[model samples]
Target: MNTLLAEPGTLTTSPIRTQQPTGPRIEVTGRMHDRFDEILTPEALAFLADLHQRFAGRRHDRLADRMRRRFEIGNGRDPKFRDDTASIRSDATWRVAGAGPGLEDRRVEITGPTDRKMTINALNSGAKVWLADQEDATSPTWANVLGGQISLFDAIRRQIDFTSPEGKAYTLTTGDMPTIVMRPRGWHLVEKHLTFIDSSGAAMAASGSLTDFGLYFFHNAQALIDSGRGPYFYLAKLESSEEARLWDDVFSFSEQHAGIAHGTIRATVLIETLPAAFEMEEILYELRDHCAGLNAGRWDYIFSIIKNYRGRGARFVLPDRSDVTMTVPFMRAYTELLVKTCHKRGAHAIGGMSAFIPNRRDPEVTARAIEKVSADKKREAGDGFDGTWVAHPDLIDAARAEFDAILGDRPNQVDRQRDDVEVTAAQLLDVHVGRAVTDAGLRDNVSIGVRYLESWLRGIGAAAIDNLMEDAATAEISRSQIWQWIHQDVRTDDGAPITRDRVERILSDLLSTVERFDGDRFDDAADVFREVALKEEFPTFLTVGAYSRFLVDLA
Candidate 1:
C-alpha cells in the first residue's frame, strides 16, 4: 500500500494499485466468503450507492430544513443566528452518559497502543476506563505515518488481552481489560480502524464526526451497518437545537437503511462551545428522541469562549485555564443549568473532564489532588450530573466512587426549577436583569447570607477571603449561595429524611457569625436589596423576614 504522512498528525494511506481477488483465500475456503458477503449485503450496497448519489450533488438542504422546523425560534432567539444543522444518529447503543454511580471515581487513561508499559500500567491500575487514543494524545510525528495508525490499532487489539509486559499469558475477559474506546482521527480514519478491528479479533466502538452534516455520518453509519456492528457516534461541537434535530432525522434515515427500529444508533453530543450552551435546552428537547446524554467539552469550550472575546477586545474577560474553573457564580449557574436542563428533559447530564492526574512520583500531592477531584464530583452529583469523565486511567475508580456515593441506586431527583416550575419569558427577563444583578434580589440575599455564613461557619467575613484566585468580588457572592441554601427551608412535609429545620439551624449560626465580622457589609447588602425591591415594586422584605423567622426558630 502507498503511504504518505500529513501535518496535524494524520496518517494517509493510498488505495492499492491492483485489486485482490474477490473470493476468499484457499485457507478459509467457503467460510470466509460466507461471512464477508453476509456482512456486506446487496441492500447495504444499494444504500451506499443512494447515499453517494444524493450527497454527490450537495443534497443536505432538505435535512437542514427539517432540523430548523423542529427547533423553532421565538422572541428571545438570536436574530442573526442561521439555521445551521448537522446530522447525527439518535439510536443510542451504550447509555449516552454512564449510569450506576461512582462516575467521579472513574478515570480514563489514554495510552499509545504501542506503549506496552503504559497500557499495562493503566490496565493494572484501578481506573475504570481506558481509551486507547489514536487521536490527539499520540505524537504527531508517529501519527503522520500510515503504518503507525494501523500498527497501533493492531497492537491494542492484540495485546490488550495479555496479562503482563513480559508476555505472560493470562485469559483476559472484556471486563478485565479497561472499557475500550478508540478515539480515531476522523471519518477518513474509519476504513483503516474498522478494517483493523474486523481483522483484530476484538470489539470496539467508533467515535468522532462521520458526517459533518447528515451526509458524512450516514456514510459511516452505512459502513458500520453493513459490517453488522451496532451503530454508535460521538457528536462534536454541536451549537444549537437545530443541530440536535438534524441528528434525530439522521437516526430516522439510518433505521430505515438498516431495517432497524428507531433508537438503534445511540449518540452523545459534546457541548463545547458558548453557542452550544445557550442552545442546550433546545438541543436536548430536539434530540432526546435518540440522545445518550450531553458532555461538557471543557477545553474546546473555554478556548472558543476566550478566543471570541479576545477578537472583540479585552473588555470581555474569559478564564485561561480549565483548572482555573468557572467562577463560583458562573459555575453555579452553569452546573445548575446543566442539571436542570438535562433532568427536565429526562436525559443524563454528564460532567466535563478533570483532565489533570496527580504526578505519580509525588504520592502525597497526587493523593490530595485526587481527593479534591472526588469531592468535586460528589458535589456535581449533588447538583445533578449523573456521570463524569477523566483523561487519566488512575483516577477512574475514584471518580466512579464519588458519583456512586452521591447517587446511590435511586433514579435521579429532578430539580424543582426543572420539573415543577415553568419559566416564562417574563420570568427569564426579570431574573436576568432585575434579580441577578441588583442588591436585595436573589443575588443580594445570597451575597448577604454568604458573608453572614462565612463569619458563623468558617470564622471569616466574605470580604476577608478571596473567592476566586484573585477576583475578590466573587468571594462574597460565593458565601451568599452557600448561606442561601443553608438558611433556606427545604423540608418536605411528606416525611422526608431531612428537614428544613435542620438546614435553618445550621445556616443561622453561620450567618450570625458573619454579622459580627462585617456588620457594615450587611448595610450595603440591605441598601442594594432595598433599591431593587422598591424600584421593581417587588415583595422583597416579606421573603427575607420569613427566612429570618424560620432560620432563628430552627437554630
Candidate 2:
C-alpha cells in the first residue's frame, strides 16, 4: 500500500491520537465530557473546521437544489434518469475499486449504534461487516457522538470490551472480526455542538457528515490501511449524483491531505431516496474509483417516496408500513434495478435490514419472525444480492445461511449480472397498494411512531417494539404513512376515513395505557409525532426538528 500519513504515528491499545490539522478556530457549544479529548482533539477539530470551510457553500447549494427538485416533483414531475449523464451509465468498461481487504465476503452484515456493548457484541456476532452507525441508529447527543468515535477507535485496535452494570462480561471473539464500515450522518444534518466561523466572520454549524468523516479519517485512515483494512463508509440519504460527486471530492481531498493513496477509501451509497433510485448507475459512475456498491435502504426509500408525493394526490399514498414489503411491485423494481446497476458496474449490491428483533419471552413468536427473516434473505440471495443486514445478533446465522447456500465458496455474486432487469420511471412510481388498509394498520402506525419517538427523545435511536427493530427510518415511514393516509382521504377496511382527529385520539389512548419508564418522554414524543404527522407541510426528517428542539444542550 505504501501510504504515508501527514504525521506518522503508531496505534497502541490506548486511545491516544497523534496527528494535526491547521485551520480556523471552531466554537464547540456542547458540554465537554471526560475522555472526549481523544476523539475531539484540537487537530481533529481543526481538520473538521477546515473541511467545513472548504465545502460549506457547496453543501448549501446542494440543499437548495434539493428543495428546487422536490418542488418540481411536487408540481407534477416524475423523476427520470438524467439525459446529461447517460454517457457515464452507458460506458461499459468502467468499474469501481471493488471489495477492499476484510470486505470480500459480506454475506452477513450486522448494523447498530456504536455504543460500547454493541461494539463488542457485533464484533463477536460473526457477521462479515459491522455497520458502526453514527447516523439514524444513533441519537447525536454530545456523549453519543464522541462515544461512538471512541468505541470505534478502540474496537479497530481490539482494545474494546464491555462489562454490564450487573456484572455481565462481553468481549470480541477470537479469530476474524467483521470489517468496520462507518455510516456518518447524511448530507442534510449538522453537528450543532461544533461551530466554525466562516470568511465573513459569521459562525456556522459544522456539517455532521463532514465532522464524522473528517475526524474518523484524520485519526484512523493510516492505521486502518496499515492493518489490512481501508477506511470504508456507507453513505446514507444521498439524493443525487451531484451529492455523490461532492462526496467523491471529499474522499479525494481527504486522501491527499492525509497523505494516503488515492482510492484507498471505499463507500457504498444508500439508494434510499426517490431521486437517488433514478440515478443509481450515475451515482456508481461518479464514485467509480471509490464506490464499492449500493444498498437498498428500503424503509427510507419508502419514506422519501411518500414525502415527495405527499400532496400529489392518491397515487403516492403508501398503504400501511406493514403492507409495503420488498416483494411489492414498486419496491421490487427498485431493488432489482439496484442489483442490475451494481453488478454491471462491478459493485456489490447489499440488501436492506431484516428488521425483526428476537422475542426471547415467546419462543413461538421468535421462531415465526426468524422464519420470515430467512425468507426475506433467501429472496435477496436468490435475486443476486451479495449480502443483507440483520438488526439482532440472533438472526446473523440465519441471514448468513441463506447467502451461504447461494454463494457457496464465492466471495460475492457481483458476477451475476441481472441483464434482463429493466426499470422505467413509471415502474418506479407504481406505489399503489390496491388492497384495503386496515384499522389495525392505522393504529399500529401511531403506536410505533410515538413509541419510537419516545425512545429517540430519551437519547435512544434504535428500539425494539413488537419484536421489530424500529430506527429512524422505520419511524419516518410510519409517521409519513399516517400523514399520507389522512391527507389523501384514505379509508380503512371498515370504511372509516383516516383523519387527523382519529389518529390523535389513538395517540391519546395509547399514552393513557402505556407504561412509562423513569425517564420516558411520551408527552414530547406525542407532540413531535403530532407536529410531523398531522402538519400540512412535510418535514425532511423527524430528527432535524426534534434534535434542535429537544436534544441540543440537553439538561
Maximum-TM-score candidate: 2
- Scanning candidate 1 in windows of ten residues, the lowest lDDT window is 23-32
lDDT of 1: 0.40
Evaluate all candidate structures by whole-model CA lDDT and list the values in order: 0.40, 0.87
- Report the C-alpha lDDT of model 2 over 105-126, residue by residue, as the tens digit: 8889999999899889888888
Q: Choose the strongest candidate by lDDT.
A: 2
Against the hidden reference, what TM-scores do the models get? Answer: 0.49, 0.95
Off by over 4 Å in 1: 1-208, 211-230, 319-323, 411-555
Error of 2 at 400 (Å): 1.0
State how far residue 212 of model 1 sits from its true place (Å).
11
RMSD (CA, angstroms), candidate 2: 5.1
